[model samples]
Target: MAEVILFYFLMAFILIAALIAVETTDLLSAVICVGAIGFGCALFFLFLRAPDIAITQIVVEVLALVILIRVTISRNATFVTGDREFFASVVSVVILMMIFLMAVQVLNSLPAFGDAVFAEVTDSASKTYISQGMEKTGAANIVSAVILDFRAYDTLGEATVLFTSVIGAAVILRKRPRKLPEEPQI
Candidate 1:
């Protein structure tokens, strides 16, 4: 069918673009290749009926491209470290692959394997919340009941910590106010 043909065509284009992105000497062209591959991936996800994920990915890809180009062109950005750091990168990648494989294996062994965990959680939460704790919590939203009744302080602490860390990071990373250059002496 035409759909299958289009899928394969996009896949082939993606693979070629990814290869060019990885192996090209020109950074700008590599960025273009990566963007093209990301666009193809978003299109593929849209075709597969994952509109939410596709939209999120496309937005992220655009933001990433903008940020990367901005950083690459910014002041103090001549930051060229030689490719001699390849060995450290190889080791980091190997360790990351091991961690990824372990995570996938753990996920595969979960009770909710091949099933949506949210549906199960919300289903059970509704039953338990309404049956036992409705009078105690007096909340109509069963999902919120389960979360708030059991983990109210935990949730509050998490939000507090997240807000604190974000504010701290912003304060630390914000550029100091620019000073005017001194006038040249006569």
Candidate 2:
């Protein structure tokens, strides 16, 4: 009971922070919102008893914060942006509201949720896993079993792309044509 209440509270906090993330004029404040939103969401997931997802969310949030801070610190105009029109902002809010309402409706329609869901989803997955898990992967880690067994190639490809992007970014960022004389430090 208390957890459900906390979940709603955290969900509200996440939505507010995410909205502020998009609306804030200051880059630093916006970045703060992005991290706050991510942490709030991770808490919400934990409240729902999904610790693994919560951990992933927290790790990704930290990575994003580090990257954003590095980029913003290197530029004075990181937060500068052309002003959005009044009509455009209004339209954006309306569309967001419609999407929220639809999501709420869909969520409300789901009969299986909360504690009752765990036993059911797990039972079903376990059955499938027992039947075909070896085909998915020969190993015994249920989580990794599901991921690697079921989606090994997909995971491998994603890792390859991530590695490629990191190497490419490092190469680009490290390139320098020539060295310049140091000026007086202000």
Quality of model 1 by C-alpha lDDT: 0.77
Model 2: per-residue Cα lDDT over 101-183, one tens digit each? 99999988776456454355755866777677766677665567766767678889989999999998888898675578889
TM-score of each prediction: 0.46, 0.71
* Clash totals, every prediction: 0, 1
What are the root-mean-square deviations of the candidates from the true structure over C-alphas?
Answer: 8.7, 7.8
Top candidate (lDDT): 2
Tell me the spans in candidate 2 whose CA falls farther than 4 Å from its real position.
Answer: 78-82, 115-127, 130-141, 171-186
The CA lDDT of each predicted structure is: 0.77, 0.81
TM-score of 1: 0.46
> Per-residue lDDT for 46-89 in model 1, tens only?
98666766987899899878866765554453443446578898
